[model samples]
Target: MTPSVQSVETEDEYIHVRFRDPDEFDTIRTPDWAAHAAQDVSEGSEVRTGKQKDSDDWEVQSVLIKKQVGEDKARDEAKQIVEKIES
Candidate 1:
């Protein structure tokens, strides 16, 4: 099953992926995926399941980084909403 990554933690020699599924996780030694997951986790992004390498192995296919809106942009949006409501 493709599980959403709930958390990523660094260990002595591995990166642990805690899945949203209860008690489901994987210790990864693959450097590429590990690094990607680490960055995504730090950025509060979503890590998507790529493919299953085998019965016991899976790969990270993509990282979905959440875009942070600027404070000015948010304020502008709020102003627009207020104007719309007043109209």
Candidate 2:
């Protein structure tokens, strides 16, 4: 099943991409791959996605972006990344 961004939140330099009832696409690999792909976005930016707690799911994740980037762009970028990865 395809996953959609359930919610998007922004912090100082981070964008959290939370999936809506994710299916098979939700795994350690999905977040790790996205994180790797996200880091290539810029020189200083970084991304992270993993289980904050062992009982939680990987669908809830976060990506760190450059401060100058807008939340809309960040979400769009994340959507592209997720689509590319899922395809």
Candidate 3:
């Protein structure tokens, strides 16, 4: 399934690319699509997936370290990571 990008924002020194996955429960048992994408990603990119303590939905976030590869590159790589999440 193709995940959708719910929003994008910058926090601290990282550009956060956020996506959502429906959770029937509070459990997040989906594949670590972000991690797998990170392996082939660049610019010190990283991803996190979890169900927030106060929310019943699961969120997938890809962060691009702005200090590492610059904002432009980081943004490109960040989106790429999200694209390659399951492709």
lDDT winner among the candidates? 3
Model 3 deviation from the true structure expressed as Cα RMSD, one decimal place: 5.4
User: For model 1, how big is the CA root-mean-square deviation?
Assistant: 14.0
Alpha carbon lDDT at 27, candidate 1: 41
- Measured on C-alpha atoms, candidate 1 has an lDDT of 0.38
Residue pairs whose backbone atoms clash in candidate 1:
none
| lDDT tens readout by residue for model 2, 1-87 | 445667777766666555543343334334455656666654344444444344555443444555567777776666655554445
**TM-score per candidate, chains pooled:** 0.27, 0.52, 0.51
Q: Ten consecutive residues with minimal summed lDDT in candidate 3?
A: 21-30
lDDT by residue for model 1 (17-56), tens: 4443332334433344443444523333334443343456
Q: For model 2, what is the error of residue 19's alpha carbon versus the real structure, in angstroms, after optimal superposition?
A: 2.2
lDDT of 3 by residue, 1-87 (tens): 546666566777777665653342354443555565675877455676566667765555435445546556666676677667545
C-alpha RMSD for every candidate: 14.0, 5.6, 5.4
lDDT, candidate 1, residue 29?
32
